[model samples]
Target: MNTHKKQGFWHRFFFSLDHKDIGFQYMLTIFVMVAIGGFFAYVFRMHLAFPDMKVPLFGLVTNKDYNMLITNHGLIMMMWLALGMLLAVAGNFLIPIMIGTDDMAFPKLNKISYWFFLISVILMIASFFMPKGGLGGGWTLYPPLSTGDFGYNTPYKGFADRFFTANTFVLLAIVFEFTSLLMGGINFFVTTLNKRAKGMSLFKMPVVVWMINIASVLFMFSVGPLVAGTFMLLLDINVGTGFYDAYRGGDPLLWEHLFWFFGHPEVYVILLPPLGILAEIISNNSRKPLFGYKFIIKMTLLAGILSMMVWAHHQFVAGINPKAATVFSILTIIISLPFAGIILAYIATLWYGKIRFTLPMKWALGAITLFTLLGGFTGLHLGASVFDIYAHDTSFVVAHFHYTLFPTVIFGTYAAMYFWFNKFTGRHLNKTLGNIHFWLTFIFFNGFAFPLFLLGLAGQHRRIADYRQFEFLMQDPLPLYRHIATISAVILILTQFIFIFNFFWSLKKGKRVESNNPWDSNTLEWQTSSPPPHGNFETYPVVHHGPYEYNMPGKDKDFTPQNEA
Candidate 1:
């Protein structure tokens, strides 16, 4: 198999089609985007908190700059950080190994997806420097504002020559990014279904494999409408089409429907994989049989299905029909029930078992308890039509989103990284730095997000760039709360540098692994070398047990390897 072949630097990092190498590419890019997105958050938050003060690293945050900051922050984090890590990176890295395959079904296509993603990032960034400036029409990119002024900018006769405006570039980015994910999703689905080793049945698959598949499927199904919507909106900008312009005989609400239709399920597309990671870590660290393995799978499918049905809840206050809102409200609440079952199953998995406080598990515990709990409960408030009307654009909604999303996107990504550090680099990340990173992250994250919840309840609208300007919005504790959130954001963003250092430092100098499976994990990936050979395994494995097998009475060790006969 020519496993000893060496490649040049470009092929190794940038130009290669190897799934592992591609995963590395995705990982590096994801972190870079994180820095960019986090900095944007710091800038906008500073603008919100201290009205006219020029941010230190960044210069003065003009109204336009403020809009651009908040808009791009949401886009980068949600688009780049979340999907880049969970779907593109995780699918490429883990799907082949965990499913007992050497590589994806289409390796070159994997490379193409990443290039598409790279182009998308560049285009979005490029949008900021366009003649009309970036699309700060809010992250949702609603029309009228996004479509531009009512005059020559409306499309056709007024603007037939110029098609590549600010919004147009960003839309192009979205189109490219969607194309990339679609390709990756197809790769994941085909690879898992077609490439499993002999005797590795669907029921015996690792929870993560199922998760990536589900996330991919959800993304595939949901993103189509948004893709169409983006194109329509793009035509509205460049080609003089009025697909979303009211004056041009198009309805803006159509864009909203197309957006959230994908938007709500889009959350689960990034979310479900982390829950899968949590299950794996909890079972390994607690040394217990994962409770309700079958049930969790069933619940996950149910949740995915319900995810599609509840997108309308996002549009309840958008002037949709009351009956439609009521239907959405009902579906939104119903969706929570399946996740309840899943969370209970996790809690039960750890019930009275031997629990280890490893870094991955610590993050998992935080995700399961504090992060998910706060996020989930608050989510219920927004699901109801009545409360949503008030909280729709308040600081409370922002708090709810980060509470839910940051956990899955940020905490979940960290847990996976720490848990698999040995496998990725054949070395352990420094433990001291990991804990410090987690605790400081936990403390400051709460300090930042929790205050917003109080401010939301206090009627603090989220879109305001300056609270000091409005007499009604200038209550005593509200300003105090803004300061608290902003200060914590600075520390939270800085705390990540410690992790970045740990990652690179550990890569070169941390303790090298002598064992194949340091975690004593039951997954097939762990059964291979620390960093597996060119083609994952020396010999393809045949699985006998399910992914999580802990503390069986006859097992020599507490955890049973999946490949063991």
Candidate 2:
């Protein structure tokens, strides 16, 4: 592989793995994925808000198509938008930089991982254009519904038995993507363990690196079961296996167990990095050391340990035995204790500090508040066996994930984008436009998802296209709730323009930056030029202090870089 600089668009931008190039590509791919996923969200929301209302803009769609939309939307948002973008993009960009590595252990392999990811994305996009349409099963691709024949008798149908072919492609693509993620994880973990410049110790590494390292460990181990399960499903579809076939004495429940075991871990995998980024942004902008930094790291470890044990909580209502449910429920609540500690630590850091309400800080703070409340409260409902009976699989369930995911993961990605844009481009983003983007998202996000909690509480089942047909909900239908949600959805879609505008506008015309440590960060990445040249540090950076040595009594400035005095 050539280590020398190149000057072409595809060579430099599309097919490069100089961590910076890979990071930007991951961001761009996921951004496009988010847009596609958001469009699906809009369509699904429209159907839910007005169960029988014909969508004026999407007249080609029908009720069966709507159900398919719901399934595809969930899959795209979870895997494509959240995981693909957050971990792949943000992880690629920040990991080496945070740990003070010049580049990944193997840059060419990094490039290979990204190219495979791009291929995976292309395959997923091709699913939508499949002859029978696309894979219609929810992201989980639960059997019976997912594997059954495609016809009117089924709840949702858009194409032919093309689900088998389309979903097969989706699965293959996902396998490649996960392979890339695993490779990246291995690189990150090894780099952190072996390559921290000259004197940076593990304990001295930033909390962001710690969080990401933990997440990478979780991904390495947790993803295996899902890969096994997906292969089983693929075989059951194509090669004629009885792994999940009940009539042949094969248990479908086994697949569920395998899927959720990996599935739930997948959520944490998507979440922790954003929180890591949030910690970095908040600590830097607020000009204070992260409170209870060690405690937060311990909590992340706890979250990972508990993540594997609570997969059955997702199966509580599926007849997994009351005693087992109770056990899982107790463990589920226990997991939240660590998260509570992390939240408290963040809030404590902000107490009486010199707070800067920049765009990155605004979203970081917003995510901390939103995720803390939602991850804690709804978690209680799911953790207690009694409430689980009522809230499981309802709109409340949907709202709970949306609250945790949209804020922590999605917003964190955007925050990192703003915080690092200048470093990547050597230019500052327009703060005014960024602020507009933040406030609008803050309002519309809650406006759109919060009401689903109420609707779920009122007994609306999830994944159905026509709610009016359900006689139980007729007496007290949630028309007003639906209206507000749909309106906000449309508005939210439009608000993303502020982001698109700010990003491109800043890249081309914003103020040029010369500061190496733009955020005055103590981490090693900040020791280099904005958009650090080819090899990250001109020479090597030797760490001399801990990550957050801020506001010492006799320091020249309030803080000093880890490599500095």
Candidate 3:
């Protein structure tokens, strides 16, 4: 950005309040969190596979540390990596550029949000080092364990010791992370709604713009209950209030209700951006107009509506009303329909078109197949109360969760990064290294995640540091599968360094982009200079077409830029 002029070290190193710098900053920071989370997954998975052997870099895994590792791993991936990247990073990067604006509606608030996120990161990491080695109460932080159960189970016992502990940092970090998300959501809303370039109507906006904004609205509505509930939880632990403490006459199920209410919708908050990214990648590579553009938008809105109503399905066994459980069960199953429709529309977009199997497209296909298809089908089993009774809290739930989130969060993120890498760096990543990274990641990701379904069916439960105690769980396929999964995870983590190497190496020495629109895609971001400039477009752009206008009969080039007449 304005590289022609010389700049000081501090100026070059720090972001200068540009949306691009902020977005990229969010992305890089999230990747660091992801690396740490991945390492945690490796440590725990290694322990699970071979309980006798000590983990490398970390010593023996006790029950407490196992719980802490898994719990913080969940928090780190969900809060820091997924939410940060999807809502804040993608919204900041895509909304302004795609809608043909120079910057976010409120830039200062945007900067503040990143600072809050960084603070949350610090608090989260610091939580582990605090007393009792972080809250092992799981990511949900459910009551009893959340109430006083975990406190009592610790090394410090009896009323003589302090009732409250180090896990407070975890909750505190979450408070800040959520607060940051809310601020970023406000910025996305204002920028997209008010700051569009001329002719860029609501309908004319790209699918990603629609998806990110809709995700923001869904989060805004659903997280309010959790936000208020989280404050109550903090009070329960710190001040000895009995908000969720069942032992203290507080209803533990209330915590579940508040959590899943936001928790279920939170899934979509992360899912939609990737789906939108996939839409852009799929359409551009296929050289076809997006199929069912308006229909996709309508279905997404319907899905958001249904997402709020189905939160109770997670509480079917929590002993809510039978009729109420039935309603949520039916609604849970129904919510799948909108996403199914959206995915089918994407598949239809690929039909009878010139398909290019670019690295991004391969990753997109992996996401649709893994997240939308396999993930969707398995989720149905959990939707029904009868099935969930058997599957919930078991390895199946973990598998299904990974199947859904890993593809979108991990696979989908890779796809988007590769697709937009040129725009971000103004240089091409080595296709050779990228191909190796893609195949290894795609194959190994499934290698690890797929076996958990069988383990769940075999009656294996979650969060057990050592499964050797249970003779039935020690059966042939079980241990064998564990080994398979652990080995795969190791390979998967190692493969990412290839991408890391390629990422930084390409920034300086990789082939320079010969043209602005290297991919010949129609989106406005591609129409600008590579990496754009401080204010983005040199002149104000007037949108003349929808984002995906490829393969026009009259044009010499198949693509039509949105700003073109």
Candidate 4:
């Protein structure tokens, strides 16, 4: 369909269908969104640290601004930052390489997906500049709050009118995004299922490819309900449909059902790729085979299947049928088991192996440890109906998600970036700066999130600017939490400089990576050149063994490329 001919550097560099170009574009977009969304976080944290405080450069960020910032932050980070980069960038970049393919099955389709992704992302970012400001209805955009008024009496017009219009744009952007992702998911799923190199079997593929394939299948099916729900919500708001209108006997709970159906699985879809990166990095750096590799694969599939039945857990407080809530609660706890198996598998992989503390390895190891601890503990809290009652919608809930996902997603992304910087830019990142980046991020990340758990335990609800009304936190929410969180946030923001320095400084001046297999990686990706040319492989590589086959007997070194063995 792309009858366009490739011209010169810019087209080949930025808009080309080469997997590497697409991958870098994905990473570049995510970085841009992070800068924008992260600024909102910085200001949001400033507000938390000093309630109703006047900020420099932007003046006072009122509660309404706070709400809009947080909502947009979640949408941007989750969709644009995490999903956009991991699935679109990493998935598109790595899948063809891992499978030993020259390029995506349909290069033109792949390029279109990236372009549409860019357009959708632009529209999403543009939402903040809307006439009435962006949608302030939380990331979930649950009705009433999302469909009702803006809740604050600003100079803005009626809440319903603004909510309807702002949210319409949001839905439209999401629809475009969904279209792109759906095509991408279908392509990836089919490519993995059918297009392995001459000898690569299902098991011979890299764990990252497996993770992406699973996520693709999950996204393919899971996105439909939300796409449908968005249309219904739009119709209800504009066309006077009763889809979400209680007056027309349509229950708002229906919206919750449809959203969470997509919502719960979307987390795993975002997570699985990074987890795959962790699996690869941890195994390679440790110089050991990934322990329970088969188990991890099985668990990934199980988690995908179990995600569907557990959607109603979000509705526990929404007055879903008590029996349904109970079922969902039980299912939610059970679903954590497969995830537990995954954590144990990661931990087990690290036991008694050669531990290299390289930047990428450090991030991989740190993510596994922190993510497991936070994921396990918070899951325990959320699993029980009794605690869920207290923790629901509280800062505890926020802290749990931040701890569990923040490290995994953000750290995993950095790990992927560091791991592939050579492949992306043909140069290595500065290790010294990278280590500093890691430590500061690790410390401040917890600092920013931990107090939230303590505050939430003391009954601080989420989505509010003023927690001073709660006397329990009155003794010193500012000192114990707000100030500390703000300081941590500032430190966190500064820590990224080490990365910016390393990323750009090294892009031009860093040591050149001579060997394609820098880490002695076992996957087929290592078989290609550093930043492989227009077609991935100079010549088609025939994969000969399973991925992660490190330390096999008679191997020249500790690892052998799947394409070589």
lDDT of each: 0.87, 0.80, 0.86, 0.81
Pick by TM-score: which candidate is best?
1
- TM-scores for all predictions: 0.98, 0.95, 0.96, 0.94
Clashing pairs in 3: none
Each prediction's RMSD to truth: 1.5, 3.0, 2.4, 3.2
Clash counts per candidate, in order, are 2, 1, 0, 1
Residues 1-565, model 3: lDDT tens digits: 3443544556543645778878977887888888889889988998888896889998888888898889889989998988998998888878898898889999889988888988998888887776556778888888767543443224434332333355567778889999999999999999999999999999999999999999999999999999888888876666666787556677889999999999999999999999999999999999999999999999999999989888988877778998887788899999999999999999999999899999999999999999876798999989998899778878899999999999998888889888888897799988999999999998998899888888889988886777777999988889998889889988998999999999989988988889998788998899888887877888879998998889988999989999999
Model 2 pairs in collision: 132-159
Q: In model 4, which range of ten residues has the least summed lDDT?
A: 148-157
Which runs of model 2 end up more than 4 angstroms from their true locations?
Answer: 1-6, 150-164, 471-477
**Candidate 2 per-residue C-alpha lDDT over 65-177 given as tens digits, one digit per residue, 9 for 90 to 100:** 87678877888788778777777777777778777777888788788888887888888888778766677877778875666353212333333343446767777877888
Candidate 4: lDDT of 200?
91
lDDT of 1 by residue, 479-511 (tens): 898899999999999999999999999999999
Candidate 3, position 434, lDDT: 94
lDDT of 1 at 455: 90
In order of TM-score, best first, we have: 1, 3, 2, 4
